[model samples]
Target: MRSLVLEDFGRLTLHHEEEPHPPAGCVAVAVAYSGICGTDIHGYTGSNGRRRSGQVMGHEASGVVLSTAADVVGVSIGDRVVINPLVGCGACGACLRGQAQQCPDQSVIGVTPSSPGAYADVVIVPAGNLVALPAALSLRLAALVEPLAVAVHAIELGRPQRGEVVAVLGGGPIGQSVVLALSVLEPQARVLISEPNADRRRLCTDLGALPFDPGSTGAGAPTDLVIDAVGHPATYAAALSTTRRGSRTVVIGLHSQQVTIDAFALTTGERSLHGSYCYTPTDLRRAVDVLTTRPQQAATLVSTVVSPEESAATFDWLASPAPPAGKVLICFTDTNEPVAAHR
Candidate 1:
């Protein structure tokens, strides 16, 4: 079997590995497609890989189940499915509170805590993490469920009302997903995007958003809700200041450093800043529902598809600032499984 291993920081090599088998309560899946995400790129270039070497590096993926352990329930072999990347104990306080992303004992796929991930010919996941995909959904686009769930969680946290003005900062997959989710939920909301990439700006327009280049111009007028997909510390202040008083600003992107904000401003205006991380099962269910139930819309957002051999190069391109039309997918060349992009 072919698997992509993060041999070290700044290096990802494809190598042969034994086929994986399902353990008790787990299922073995033949990965059909996996998408390279920001977190994967971070592990590739940052300190994560150096500290946790040789981690199997993919999480956003979809595949067909080859087999399942005796204890695995709910899904069967030959089912097409998308893997939910979070592996958390369901009995914790956070889990009980529906905040599983904050579970004290959570482990994520492709990260330090979980076993090898979907950037392989075969991977095993707890049966519960497998969300069955609709037969009509292509494997390539189905892989986007993970990232799309993150955006869904962000919108869930923000709780925007229909017709409210919303701003999405950043134009990456997650950011674009936010735009799509918001548009779908609130068709009347004035959705705007702050992205510097010309290609991404065009994508925003295609999704029915007004584009504002943050680096070149001020984030248009104050928006009722602002979703910061680019959570870099440097951009926090600008994002915070551009929001309407009493409105909400959702922080969905990961920032590595301490970010300074106007505490006094927030206090005075009674505005709120909320941080949204990973998704729960409900979020995943909603994402899958949206993708499978609306294949046409899903296809429009899937821009590129590549073979596993091209996955590494795609990550490099995503890491560097490039024009992004939509999500880039890595698909198995030999499968009849659905690929999200146009033919």
Candidate 2:
């Protein structure tokens, strides 16, 4: 197996290594495609400080099952699946409630330093974390399930009403996913996207969202609901300031560690702000449904795909200023699994 290792904060080096075998209640997946997440770029740029050298840091991915331990009954060899990544101790209270992110001992496959990730030819995942893909969903588009799941969870938190106006505070992959979520789940709701980049704004517009410059006139006018996908202090303040009184706002981006909150803006308007990080089990399932049904909308977010050898340069480019508008995937071409771009 070939693994992409984080040799340093800003460098990723590929090395040949032995393939890992799955243990009890686990399965081995031959990776087809792995999406480079914003968190991965932040880690590569040494801005997140959550990733470290010698760690394998890919989480958004899809693959075909290679092998499974004896007790893995739900999935078998040759099944195409999306890696759920977030694993919880099933016996815990939070895990029992299906909120894995709140589990005291939860471990994300790529984020946890000890576990290998999908940046390699294969990844070892717990059987429970595998979401079996239907024949309708292609493996390439399936790599987006994780991030789309994040948007699904955020939308769930915001709970936008029918025909209400919703503003998304960025036009990156996650922001684009949020628009797609509304398109698939609640098409009646009008969506407005604030993005500085022309390409990103156009992508959102093609998805039936209105694109506006965040700094433009009338940009901060109150809307029924606002989702701050950028999560900077500026965007956080924008979310609060742009949402109408008694409206809801959800913050999903983690670009910065600390954001200064405006007590007056929040208190006077009586706006409710919600923090969303990852998806629950139900949200992940809906993400698969979203991709399986509205594949073309999901396909638009997959902007580029590169081979494993190109992973380093791809990471560098994404971490650089003004990266491409949408998602970039690292494809492991040697895998027998099909990696189709669209239906």
Candidate 3:
């Protein structure tokens, strides 16, 4: 088996490795399509942490189950599925309360060592994390369920009502997902996206969102809800200013660096800002359904795909300060086909 591993900070490579076997309660998936997530980029650049010599580097993934334990009742061998990467300690207070992502003992598969990741030919995931992919869903498209779940969680946190105006302040994968989920759920709401990238700006427009350049105009109009998808210091400030008095703002993006928000703004206008993290199983189910049902929109979200051998260069391109688009898929199957090779 061949796998892409983060050898160290600023380095990734494709190398031959052994395929994993299913453990007592685990399942082994022959990865078909895996996404190069923003977190993977952060891991590579040492933003998350210095890579542990050879760790598999993928979490957003969909694949066919090569094998599963007999105890796994709902799913079986050869079943196509999408992985919900967060693994929680079911005994914790948060987990007991059904908030697994916030559990003190929770750990992500690709980020933490207790579970390896999807970059390999065979990746082992707990049976609990597997969600069966719908028949109509493309394997490539189904891989997007994780990020879409993140967006769905954000919308639920903000609780935006119909007819309200909302602004999403980033055009990356998570930001795009926020726009998609919000638009689909609240059809009447006015959705705007603040993105500096031209290609991503166009994508936002194509997805039925009003694209605004944050650098030029900070959403000249008052918004009812603001989703900070970038979570950078500057965008945090913009998120505060874009919303109207008493409006709610949701912070969904992961910010590793220090970010400052004006305390006066929060107190003066009665504006509330909420932090949203990973979603529950319910959000994953909804995200999977949408990805399967809407093939056209799913195809548009994916900007590029690369084979395992090409993952290093492609990932480097994606990890740069400016990426062309939000989603980049990496196919682990031995097809030797580049996603945009024909172009």
Candidate 4:
């Protein structure tokens, strides 16, 4: 099997490795499409400390089940499925409470060095983590379910009310997904995205969001809810300042920078700030439903598809000051042939 390995910070190399077999209660999937996520880019640049060198770092993927262990149920050989990369200690307090995403002993597939991820010809995972895709959904599009689930979880935490205005800071894939989730989850609410990149701003506008350059947008009426998907000090401050009194703000981006906030204003305004992490199984299922039903909207977010051999170059491009704005799908199989036939 061919796998893309993170040799070091800002470096990716292709290596031939032995194929993995399914463990008990698990299945082996021949990866068809893997999405190059922002987190992957962060890991490649050593910006995020979660990933390390020598790890096969990719979690957003969809493929066909090549084989399944005898103990596995519900999922069988040849089933088309999307992988949920978050694996939690089932006995943890958070897991017992149905909050696997918050489990203290959680290990994300690609982020954790112990668990080789989907950036390969084949990958193995527990059967419980596989979500069957609808026959009509393409594998390339199904690779997006993971990030869309993140947006779904963020929306759940922010809890925007109908007729309220929602502002999303950052126009990256996650930010754009948040805008799309808002459009689907709360159709009546107005969606606004603050982005610096003109291409990203235009993409947001195309997705039914009102795009604005945060630097130029003067202090106007505060929004009802603001989600900071950028996760920088500046964006965090903007999120707090642009949120209306008594409104909520959700932080989903991962940044190591320290931020200072006005404690007095926060106390007097009766505002709420929440940090959203990965999503629950229910949220993942909901994301699958959204992607299946709203294919056109979901497809618009995919900027381009590249092969595993070209992924290193793609990562290099993403490390640029201003990379192309949208999701990049990595096709592991032959581009001319469909890896899994649609039912």
lDDT tens string, model 4, 1-343? 8999999999999999788888898888889899998889989999878789999999998988888887887876778889999999999889888799889899988889999999998888899899988888888889999999999999999998989988999899999888888878888988889888889888888889986545565745678898989788888777767777898889998874567876666678898889999999988888888888778988989999998889899999998986888999998866246455211
- lDDT for each residue of candidate 3 in 221-336, tens digit (9 for 90 to 100): 78899889887888888877777899898988777467778989988989998999889888899888767666687688998888888888887887767676868888886423
TM-score of 1: 0.91
Q: Encode model 2's per-residue lDDT on 220-300: one tens digit a residue.
A: 456888888888989987777677899888999888888898889889989888999799978999999988888987888
Instruction: State in Å the error of residue 62, model 1.
Output: 0.6
As for candidate 3, its clashing pairs are none
Off by over 4 Å in 4: 213-219, 335-343
| Model 2: residues with Cα > 4 Å off, grouped in runs | 214-217, 334-343
Candidate 3 lDDT score relative to the true structure: 0.81
Model 4: worst 10 consecutive residues (lDDT sum)? 334-343
Candidate 1 stretches greater than 4 Å from native:
47-51, 213-221, 321-325, 337-343
Ranking by lDDT: 2, 4, 3, 1
| TM-scores for every predicted model | 0.91, 0.95, 0.93, 0.95
Q: Please identify which of the two predictions, 1 or 2, would achieve the higher TM-score against the true structure.
A: 2
Q: What is the C-alpha lDDT of each candidate?
A: 0.78, 0.87, 0.81, 0.87
What local lDDT does model 1 show for residue 279?
93
